[model samples]
Target chain A: EAGVVQSPRYKIIEKKQPVAFWCNPISGHNTLYWYRQNLGQGPELLIRYENEEAVDDSQLPKDRFSAERLKGVDSTLKIQPAELGDSAVYLCASNERGRNGELFFGEGSRLTVL
Target chain B: AQSVTQPDIHITVSEGASLELRCNYSYGATPYLFWYVQSPGQGLQLLLKYFSGDTLVQGIKGFEAEFKRSQSSFNLRKPSVHWSDAAEYFCAAFNAGKSTFGDGTTLTVKP
Candidate 1:
């Protein structure tokens, strides 16, 4: 089976510009997650989805970051007027519900804000 | 809140040498532990996990981790390091369907 798929492996944009990242989780997976990984740091949770419902998104920056999972399969993360500090890798992961928390991750979308 | 800590930011080992990467966690309940590896420009891959029985868990790529409840630690070990083992390793704690990751440790294997 194919792993989680993310589009636009690399992106470069200027500050104050809007950028979006897309992800398609593994087939039959019921949970999806979005995480951000800064250089030299581990991945941090941005949002999590159980099917089409976003169950945990408290860590997401509401002012500039927004995410949505449509039909409980594909997800999109958008950053509007992104700041220079937003340059990092956006990782998408998924797992089967109640599977002891083993996650399968994608190659991630690397964003560079200049 | 649950969290994980990796004290070593970087480690160097010669090929064929033994390797150990330390991880410490803080949680209120029985912790679900995991170890993941990330190569340059790649996504994180599960190495091993410790959930219930068996303090020692074996995983892919000749990796193993031992869970010590007394120490609140789950350390990854390899008897002999390989050049391909050079990558970033992350320790994580899982609870309520979410995971908290530690700052990873970068491993460099010298030939």
Candidate 2:
């Protein structure tokens, strides 16, 4: 079985520029999540989607960050005017329909904001 | 609120040596504990999880974790370390609608 897939394994952008990452979840997974992992820290959830509907997005920066899962299979996370602090690994994960199921993760997209 | 704590930031052990990583958690409700491993430039992989029943849970790659409810700890251990096991490990606690993860522990294996 294929695991979650993400694009642009690495990205570099200057401050104030825009950056985006994409993720493709495993087949049949009903829930997808986007998380940011900082240096020496565990991943922090940015958003969660139950199918195509976003169920949680409290940690996302509303001013500059936005995410969408239009087809419920693939997702895109965008950060406009990226800041230096936004430099981190963006990890995409998915789980079964049940909330307590284990999550499967993609390799992730590492972004470097200068 | 739920939270996890990994006391050690980094641990180094020679190959074939036993290894143990400490983790603690805080939550008001019945806790769900998890362990994940991340290799360099890779995503996090589930190791094991404990929701209820047995305190000892076995995971992939010869890993195991013991959940202690009274102490609020879920510690990961391995009988022998391997070079391939060098990576970062995270402890997470889940309850209610939210989950919390520890900072992480980086394991270094010596040949």
Candidate 3:
């Protein structure tokens, strides 16, 4: 079984530019999550999806950050007019339903906003 | 609000020595606990988890963790350290369908 997969392992953009990251979760997984990790810090949950429904997105920056999982298998996280502070690693993880602790993560997409 | 804390920012241990990483969590109810390791340029990998029953849980790569309800702590340990053990370790807690992660601890192994 392959682990979660993410695209654009690294991205560099100037401030005010738009950026997007994509993720493909493990097969048969019912839950997907997007997280952001700053330098020297652990990953913080930005959004979570159970199937096609977003069960949690309280921490997401609604003003500039948006995410969607149309068919529940893949997800996209977009940041429009990204600021310098938006530079960080965006990680995607997935797990089966009722299994909250066993998460499989992807290599993550590193974004640099200058 | 549930939260996880890793008191140590970094730790260095010599190879073949024992190792311990501290973690603490805050939650009203019993939250699911986990430990994950992330190598440089790699994704997070589950080291161990504690849901119920046993307080001590063993995981891959010779890792083990002890969950203490009284202390609200779940600490990771290894009997013998290896150079490959150098990586960033994160402690996480899941509660009420939400998850929280600590600031992570970077471990360095000295040969």
- Mark the regions of model 1 whose C-alpha exceeds 4 Å error after superposition: none
Q: What is the lDDT of residue B16 in candidate 2?
A: 99
CA lDDT, every model vs. true structure:
0.95, 0.92, 0.95
CA-based DockQ, model 2: 0.72
Better of 1 and 2 by lDDT: 1
Task: For model 2, name the residue pairs that clash.
Answer: none
Q: Lowest lDDT 10-mer window, candidate 1 chain A? A: A94-103
Residues B5-106, candidate 1, lDDT per residue (tens digit)?
999999999999999999999998867999999999999999999998999999999999999999999999999999999999999998877799999999
Ranking by DockQ: 1, 3, 2
Model 1 global lDDT (CA atoms, 0 to 1): 0.95
Task: Please give the distance, in angstroms, between residue A90's alpha carbon in candidate 3 and its true position after superposition.
Answer: 0.3
- For all predicted structures, in order, the TM-scores are 0.98, 0.97, 0.98
Instruction: Please report how far candidate 2 places residue A83 from its true position, in Å.
Output: 0.7
lDDT of 3 by residue, B27-91 (tens): 99979999999999999999989999999999999999999999999999999999999999999
